[model samples]
Target: MIKTWHLGDSRQSMVLASFDGRLPEVVYWGPALPDGESHQAIATASAADVSGGMVDRNAAVSLNPEASQTFPGHCGLSVRDKNGTPLAPAFRFQTETASEHCLTLVFADNALDLTLTFNLALEAKSSLFKLQSSLESADEIIVEWLAAPVLPVPAHADEMIEFSGRWCAEFLTRRVPFAPGARVRDNRTGRTDHAHFPGLIVCSQGTGNTSGEAYAFHYSWSGGHKMVAEELQDGRRHVQFGHASGSLPVGRTFRTAPLYATYSENGLNGAATRFQKHARNLVADGARSPRPVHYNCWEAVYFDHKLDELRSIASQAADLGAERFVLDDGWFGRRDDDTTSLGDWVIDLRKYPDGLTPLIEHVKSLGMEFGIWFEPEMINEDSDLYRSHPEWVLGPADQIRGRHQLVLDMSRQDVRSYLYEHIASVLKHHDVGYIKWDHNRVLPVVDASQTEGTYALIDRLRSDFPQVEIESCASGGGRIDFGILERTQRVWLSDSNDALERQRIQHDAALFLPACVTGSHVGPRKCHTSGRVLDIKLRSWTAAQRHMGFEMDPRELTEQEAATLRMVTGWWKANRDWMMQADILRLDSSDPAIIAEQQLAADGSRFVAFAAQMRPSDQVLPHPLRLTDLDPNAIYKITLINQDEAPALSRGAPLLKEHDLEVSGQYLMSHGLTLPWRFPETIWVLEGRRL
Candidate 1:
């Protein structure tokens, strides 16, 4: 799709890109390819673009203009008209390499068909690259890159492009995914990088005071082009690039040749769809997200929960008007906590005389939604399934060793079929309205032979059973990826339930996914990540707008805490409309104690700003706080939740405090009433508005 040329000598190097209007493209950084005279002709067949077969290439073959010869910094590739014009930005965004790996663009198709030939003993290798051609296909994409596999000190001393890894030994979709894999080449002087994603990674070549240099390669797609950034992994470097907004899904496969990465035909669409990110359309007007602000029953009872205990919890939830009740770990067969009896989806009859049916009905009787948890992706070594077909567990496709914690071979067709049938039976048998889909481990080993099929069988399973809402949890944030989001409703923020940990965690997460990302708040005292106490205001504020829920036992709360929760419950029920669709703004974060505020609006007239106060101390300003989203001049009635409700105060009276935006330290900081004072305050309810 995008093509670039690299002209480098022992001294300096220049990389440039040229487009033929084959696709829409953009450039985030400059010094692109200058139009040049034709000097060479193709000896073989050539027709602009080839759609699939990218999986086979060790990496891209074309080069870009103006890129760091030492390290491929954040330069990009874009396609253009025959006149070689640059497309503008819309869906495309400039990527930044922060501490973590940055994935700019991802594209997938059912099949990829490309071929590479390495002479095995030659200095050079030739490959035919193909890409995003057909709009539809649900098969495998084939890629063949590598002169040969690296076998220690190559017996032949030849530069080769061997399959260091299978970008897709096996994959699913109508096409293949632009999977990330790298090939490091050491022809003479040192090692050169080859990656599956775009951007340059500055590897440690014994340079500077660095402890082995490494650059985070950023992958991004915009307006029909792909761009990347190379940032020093060492903490001493901080490159604050602008944030990417709107939508973008580009395809720029990273492969290895040597010197630098190059592209050919079918350049990435800055705002195109990815190989895996298909927006299976779960949102539309009035189509409320299936997520709920309900509590989890685990920490409340551990694995010792009985039917009666569950029913009691359900009763309290209903009293608080909670819409859902989830029955966590223990209920399945003999399984309890994380120890034994996992992989046993059957219910433990000893826990109840009447089985899950009665519990489901009872939860339903309380008029709340019912959901169950399952760790189907894995099994205990002692599981009957393991004993019956141990080969179904993940092991070396070609004799790789170590019997890991039993992982279901979702890559196998038989395993996929069997899992689907069994789970469907359980689901159809219950009156459950939701399923908490959890996969608690990492996948480093895979056996994806033709007989095994794609490990993405989970996606197909969700497609087949779309009736109930699915909340994904991988011991918290483990398996979180864009692919999984297409099939589920929400994901647990982390295994740690600490409110403080969540403040940072949730912020980092929302940088990518949408608001449906859910966070849980265990009650009053210590819980989750931090066994530390969280003030009610703090917990509520941090979790508001996201899916808010209570986890700790209710009766344990002091009368004051119970009263506070009751208020939250009522407020949540009445004002949920705003939380779902309103735009959000960050108010304050100078203090971790002040988690901050978010507001949503239906029209220009209906708006609500929600703020939660965590740690209240001398650090808090004594001055009035000004709200950011406030209308500069509109006067409206404000409700200071607690103050307005005090019996000593009159109704309709001004719990209303005047809020104004003033300059403080070269910034527009809001001046407003302080916390607990406005704990449940409805900042303002605009009758006739301006904001």
Candidate 2:
């Protein structure tokens, strides 16, 4: 017997086939197929020819590749009985469920009484595919590893782009070629660590930003994850993503997180725009519109929380058009520093004798909504909560600490209750509108339930106080994933406020995150983290590229710097409503030194291009910056918005610098714009309006 099924949106489709009532495997996944295309024929054509040394019939790389089937590559599921004896499950198709946009398949291993199920859904608008797998047994079993539904990699794809980075430098992209053996990435760090971002982009050779075919995958689990891109000896290739191996304890049922995948015919931008739209329209749908301009005090004041100093800073920030002010860290417990105050959510009497109300009121009086920081998932031995209940900590008592702190046992009901109560008390008392939810340390043990518990707590709070917003900050960009983003509204992209670093980080992160949910802030003149000093123009424009904010001490800015910053802040505010919905398109600059992107408005009526010269070009002349995703027939009036900021060294009078020039979109995209020459560390901002 043969069974075939397919699900798709307008842009792409996925077809799965099952033979002999066995588990299903994806046969075709790419551009949308014709309405009458035969899925059975596609499945038949997907088969490989048998050879002498190989088994009589090559075992299918089914959804749940089984050891019993003798499938040569990595098996999809690994489990054992309670007594440590391994159980080889042979799943046979039992039932199936289908919906308009979703499909579910069930198979059972009658001997072990084990049932394995797979759920696949295609998001209607974004055309992104979501797949997951679940397992249930009659008796308790230990699940070593259970992968999501496996899908085949296109044979034509030659290289895959994977994400990796360290603290203060996240979302670094690396390209790996598709070779003979398996290329596996196993992230064992309890949370989605900065080292692995749980995303991959597989592209055919010669694929660039604007053109060529590409496929993207993101494992949506905030906890540790494992990804495998393997090429079998016979040349068949498959990709699998799931929770890290051995992360789940012995249980009767196990389920993997949703694996988000999409196929793009228009290159990296096609996949990026889909992910960005999905994140904004679905993941962060509940977030407030006209996202408020933000000012965070971490870089400005560090752990010092003097009321008078903070009130003065709030006044300055407010005058500079900051709509919200967040008092970050050191506001609670006896926490003068990072070491002694985590997990004690109570307001520190030493820092605020009258409690947070005074500072919150002061910030509110300055016409800015108040926000405060909390590291609820972590604990310090010096904290009152930890002193009272040392047993609440996760992992072994002798386990080493991270950032001088231990992780709270989020899985425990009592622990969740305690944290909710304390955090809720503060929210109830103050007129707070935002919470900078921070996770400063990684868990000592990898437990999926811990992430579930954190989700529960955040869900409960968001349910009660729907108006309050939360920003996910795990030492910045550490715990950023779809799972965490579903609960929080914004992400602190990186802790390093250096514009030069942020320029690259933001550009790379645009693949998965939309500007509305990415918080970019202007740091001090001398970046505290990188110690790189940049001009106010570069700093201001970099922050303006996303959900703009300021983290520097407003009092430290000179008159000239303040005026320039104020002018940029005004421009951001004026354009934010539309820019929030704009698609950030990374421009293809021929010049190696220029890192540029164009934020094309959702309506395709206007766009603003930011071409930042990181260093001196190898060639003396500047390269024409080519834009993307514009109407070829339309004429656009292009003007350099920051022409006045050009340094004296830029003596040449480029047409953009002198006055506006009306040009065809074809000309702008083909021949491109010839921007005025500028010094390194400077950016050219060009505004284009369709006419």
Candidate 3:
């Protein structure tokens, strides 16, 4: 009559129930329930009473809501028969398979020969719930819309936070209040685009970074994704995420990407830490420890690749403590600029005259590993690859181009094969250790198959060359998501290296990304993307906040600027072993002008808090910066690492400016730290250790 399943970790539990052999619905999901709790009672308690305007019985908003069931809100599944006629088949539970951490439920519409399956699992270490759904038919059917297993939003949540951004500025959070109707975001860009990053955070009435209840959701998909957060007339709410509608073509079987969700009782940081841990420990592979000081020559030598000049830059980068040197773009085929030579993965003899060997060897001689860039998913009309295989491009010939390029139909095996051979050739012959994989343009059409094909190629290459690490850079942060991170080891967070912009971008992005996998490079004094000239101190400290690196030409640095950068790089290296594993917690700053974060070590022994004064404070006096996630009983010795950077105008004697002070965690978190004043575009670094 009634069947139920429960999946839980130490932190959270999820209970699902099938009423009268119909499709199942999530009856409970939140804090971990006691072992003796009855799931049957929970399912019964989740039922709603009938009203005058409602149907005789409340229609179940099950894992996959059906249109035939008379549901009020958005249906989870939309389908059509072979002849383009709509099919509204109500699924009934047929069978189920269960495990301690995973559960699979299969429901079938016997009359229509349609079978629907829901698979749910709890990641053991991360405590994140993963859910997905699939459809199968005895006859071919066209799937219009199919969501991953739907989950109910807590009634107490008042607002939701979704990520939105553009080139040079990524991971901007937007807060949307829940209204009566659905808040939908349909990204037809055909990539895990910058405009709509496939992640959401629903917070209770009053939630902040350090405290209050929050629920995080991310669709681990790289294709065009569709998100729907809706409220029903009955006050119930649900959220759905899957590939964009029509992304899947007519087929006998279809499936949704894994929807990763986690409940956070300890505010956004709890969810953030889980996602970060999952990304670092499970998803990403071959990430070098100590996260080598990255040096990318993109901003320095965009398309002008000269062997002797690159050797000089590499030598200077190595002197500045760069452990990895990446030759970004313009290394291949007649590639003079963005207008030509995409999809051609070959070393330009005109640039090197010999090959990449001399430059790579020169870089290695300076004690840095060699890395190269490749835009494997794009093609230029002026290139040899496009001329030879014009039919290999995705979408129509008349489709608008992005950055003078077209999408290479990753869905084609031949295309993937061609890319693999050329990309693999370089890896085979040379001692190349890393690849800066770039996707410069959006797809002409929203097709899920394109993402799948890209994954296959990456998987194949990863299988063949497990030692070589890859960094996913879609024109800088365009294609960043859990799906891409699973195959690649790192991500170029954004193209804009302006420290002021990065201060906010990195703070907001901390909701899902961790430092080790997030690449932050110090740009030129005048940022190439934003053209904002910032001091070397702000630039160096900002870069040190994450996986530290430098992208600017070392030759441009003044003697003092170079010395300051060297000092910061050395400091980063000194603490990187522990800092790389630290939890980046966003501090709730009293001053809106200040964006700060505390990187607490995994073992809770030490921390470094960075407070960047973005603008002049609204008030004359600065507010005390309170830290989070510290033991109230412990006494810590705190010191301002950059006390000397205080401006001449900052005549006030803040306790931190003079000397290190020992204070209890309660005092620090409550009354907070008092530091010397800093001008706009400057940051204060506070280091603390439990005494």
* Cα-based TM-score, every candidate: 0.59, 0.99, 0.99
Structure candidate 3, residue pairs in collision: none
Q: Runs in model 3 with CA error above 4 Å?
A: none
> CA shift at 450, candidate 1, in angstroms?
13
* Alpha-carbon runs more than 4 Å astray in model 1: 1-25, 28-228, 231-291, 396-404, 446-456, 588-593, 602-606, 610-638, 642-691
lDDT tens per residue, model 1, 33-52 = 33452212210112234246
**What TM-score does model 3 achieve against the real structure?**
0.99
lDDT of 2 by residue, 1-691 (tens): 6899999877898999999988998888899998999998998897888997899888888887788899888889989999999988989999999999999999999999999999999988778898999999999999998999998887899899999999999999988999988999989888898989999999987888999999999999899999999998888888899998768978899999999999999989999998898888754556777888999999888998899999999999998889999999988888888889788888889879998888888888888889989888999999888889999999999998788999998999999999999999999988989999998777788888999999999999999998899999999999999998889899999998999999999999998999999999999999999989999999999999999999999999999999898999999999999999989888778887999999999999999999999999998779899999889999999999998877788888888888999999999989899988889999999999999
lDDT of 3 by residue, 1-691 (tens): 7798999977999999998988999999899999899999998888889989889988887898878889888999989899999988988988889888989999999999999999999999889999999999999989989999999988898899988999988998988998899999999999998888999999976788888889899999988999999999888889999899779988899999999999989989989999888887843467787689999998898899989899999999999999999999898998999999898888889897889899988999999989999889999999999899999999999999889999999889899999999999999999999999999888899999999999999999999999899999997889888899999999888988999989988998889888998899999999888888999999999999999999999999999999999999999999999888888999999899999999999999999999999999998888999999999999999999999988899998887888999999999888999878779889999999998
Q: Is candidate 1 or candidate 3 better by lDDT?
A: 3
Predicted candidate 1, C-alpha RMSD? 15.5
Model 1's TM-score against the true structure:
0.59
RMSD of each: 15.5, 1.1, 1.1
Candidate 2 C-alpha RMSD relative to the actual structure = 1.1
lDDT of 3 at 70: 92
